[model samples]
Target chain A: MEGEEQRDGSRGGEAVNGSDSPASLDGIEAILNYEFRDKRLLEEAFTDASYSPENCSSFERLEYVGDSVLNFLITREQYFSNPNLSPGSLTRLRAANVDTEKLARVAITHGFHRYLRHNKADLHQKIEEFGRSIEEYPLHSNGMIKAPKVLADIVESTIGAVFADSNSIDIVWKIFKELMEPLITLKTMKKHPMTELTEMCQKRNLKLEFRDRWQETKEIEVLIEKQLVGKGSYRKKLIAQNRAAKNALDNLDAFFPQFNQPCQPM
Target chain B: MEGEEQRDGSRGGEAVNGSDSPASLDGIEAILNYEFRDKRLLEEAFTDASYSPENCSSFERLEYVGDSVLNFLITREQYFSNPNLSPGSLTRLRAANVDTEKLARVAITHGFHRYLRHNKADLHQKIEEFGRSIEEYPLHSNGMIKAPKVLADIVESTIGAVFADSNSIDIVWKIFKELMEPLITLKTMKKHPMTELTEMCQKRNLKLEFRDRWQETKEIEVLIEKQLVGKGSYRKKLIAQNRAAKNALDNLDAFFPQFNQPCQPM
Candidate 1:
């Protein structure tokens, strides 16, 4: 065990000690299960422009490259496996897997945020709120929760770093195949609450209207046939509207037991 | 030359002859310069769902995969080649290279559409119109001309078939590198006239409005402060609007010499 620890320590150096290293990229290699050939790429991946204004070169480029790599990798996998899947379905499946919420979840699950070098003031609070919000859905809140874009960016940048270091897509895939765990399969994927609610209402010929009180009250209410079915409030009007739609979906059964009954189109 | 033809002929068999063959996939291999190991994939790539209603399979799947492959290939190339290029510029460059019009031009240049098996009416007329329209703007017309989607689909499907056949991205790149010539680079890329018009108008504090006369006369007129500056008509309303914008841009200097002069904000 001592020999193993020494071998690992020798590879990671300052990362193993859990101390403030010169590079400040401690424990990242262990989390990724892959070490970088050029440690600077790793450092760059974690560094945000806000943290070091003097060094304007941030992870945007890496994030961009990583975004393409992730998209291609996911597309290749899903294209071959789902032989009968339509292009539309494939697109949705790919989006669900690599979207901001999904990538943010990946970052949090691996504790990637602990290593991110950013000076954004409200990021921590937003992340905390996201953490709490995700607990309700456990898989994906679709559009109900707001995910910090930086978390997703870091995850992409890390993938970009690995690709740039190795210059081999196969190697990147091998490393990330396991890292992106519990891959959102077609069977496990869920429709956005807004879409679900709209479809349900359309099928039943029920009148659906979103009353916007966002400017005055920062709240959105979903009304069906002049009766308030659900209400949700958020700082962002779009989020509030999505949440209201979700709330309406959740309470549909109790609010209207005859929701399934066909009615005259309004 | 006859011996070489015989050798090539043996490989492609029915695909080589100009006559009706078992697969009806003739002359495609010669055009592409890369023969497929699975001839059925070639046939499938060329086959439209309308051509074989019984099979109910089309080039859509292959086109989807090819679209992904082409996007990734362009991204990888541009990312490495233009180290100083920002993500926004990179995106625009990639889009200029892979958009429907550009790909359709590729199809026409290589005669890839000759082997396509589709039963759509008016396709020939559309292709001919596209051919004539492209003559005016040797490169891209930005948004002035409409491209037949089937032409682009075949190019993507062929690329997808080649990738699937070899299961090697490098091979696909190698085969397509020369085939996809005159790639739109930063130097060659031109902004859409609509975008240019909007920018020019905004800079000059000019109020530009598009009046839709499509329902009455299949025309879209561009008005600057209620004065008619340009008029354009097309079967498609969107195209008509774009052409009106382009016309407005062309006549901007003559119509409003005071455009460069700073004006009071509306």
Candidate 2:
């Protein structure tokens, strides 16, 4: 686990010395548009504990700080931008922006994953699968997809590193605000499929039930008024449940022909 | 609920026009040692939703902002102060400082509750009970006592109002760092009684169990090695459980003579 070249240096600019070349670090810096005063902060931000437990510090502490900073920044922005937004709405909006899937999307979209230093055997495959899964949901999968938390951790840790180095939140905001483009606004934010479906059913006084076949077949079926409206299957029960809800939402018109208005796509 | 005097004036200095006088506001400002740029923010911070709902705004929005600001401020302080602290420890420290019981203690210590404008019928009685209950536990009850959440919310809202007024976190910290005195450090922080009891039992290879009679009698009994060692009863089942755990910790020496070390009092 320890090598002379890997363990001897300051662990700064490890991006250049590790498996990736110097160009990889440069590419990430280009994406961030901010040069690190202490490149070790950057290295620490991207280094996972599984990578080199003895040589490199993990991103957990930075991620912790970054989580708070991002939450406050988003709260401040939305609080002022939407003066009429209630606390509940503000909370939902902030969650949409900073939740695991959203931050993971940010990391993947900017190719920050390419710069992450990790030795976990399955991370590459997980990232590849996440990349493929996200193509189905352009913005957020809500609870349907399980995003690798490491991706979000790196994004937060990077934010934390910038805030730590500059000691100026304004600079951090200026750099990340654009990179986190197309920020999920109230207009674009979608409720989770399960919530939407449940609420719709309740509003219409319709009985809704979910049949759990996940124990045997990894499948979940949604029933409305004793009619089989939707079925979904996935490796994870939660994902299957969410997918079933989404399927029910999509086929709502078919199930209830009297109300033919198409439910908006999530 | 509307009156001529309440409806005519700007809700800015309602603290003076409403139940309390200008002197009360002045006294609060003196306690805070920081005058608000907009007195309305101060008024808004203290106004509960139950008070003058038609004419005056509540502190919910400010509380929301303040909650975020406080979380960030504590995170930043702990992150910088304890360079080697793990994220888990940092989180626990932050939580110890900002949790409802801790913040409520701050409010009670400073007599901030005296100026809260609310129509809560039982608030006065609740505050009195909290005041009396806290006398037994000087630092924190750690889930043993039920602290009124409103007391904590007002403290946070005041922090938010100050931050919003000055648009400076430094000023808010300068004013609050002392008011929130005797901040619970790692040395002073106490684990929840239940957690302590469980850990002790597990360490000693002792079988510990909680017999819940809370539904019928509002009581919880702790048994070790099938011997009833401790029992507690409270109106709240959770509080009863915690007290039971505390009782078990207190009687550990009597139950096991080999280990005579007195358990640390929370």
* TM-scores, each model vs. reference: 0.85, 0.88
Query: Candidates' DockQ values?
Result: 0.74, 0.82
- Weakest 10 consecutive residues, lDDT, candidate 2 chain B? B10-19
Docking class of 2: high
Best by lDDT: 2
In model 1, residue pairs whose N, Cα or C atoms come closer than 3 Å (at least 3 residues apart or on different chains), thus clashing, are none
lDDT of 1 by residue, B1-266 (tens): 12454335434233122322222364667666677888878888888777886674789889989998888888889988998898899999999989999999888776666677878777777877787788798889898889999889988998899988888899989878777888989998999978888888887867889999998999999998788999888888888888999888788889899876776666
The residue-by-residue lDDT of candidate 1 on A13-65, one tens digit each, is: 23112322223364677767777888888987888888885664688888988
Which regions of candidate 1 deviate over 4 angstroms? Answer: A1-23, A53-56, A213-218, A225-227, A255-266, B1-23, B211-217, B222-230, B252-266
| CA-based DockQ, model 2 | 0.82
lDDT of 1 at A199: 86
Q: What lDDT is reached at residue A230 by model 2?
A: 93
Among residues 3 or more apart in sequence or in different chains, the pairs in candidate 2 whose N, CA or C atoms overlap within 3 Å are none
The positional error of residue B60 in candidate 2, measured at the CA in angstroms, is 1.0
Q: What's the C-alpha lDDT at position B19 in model 1?
A: 26
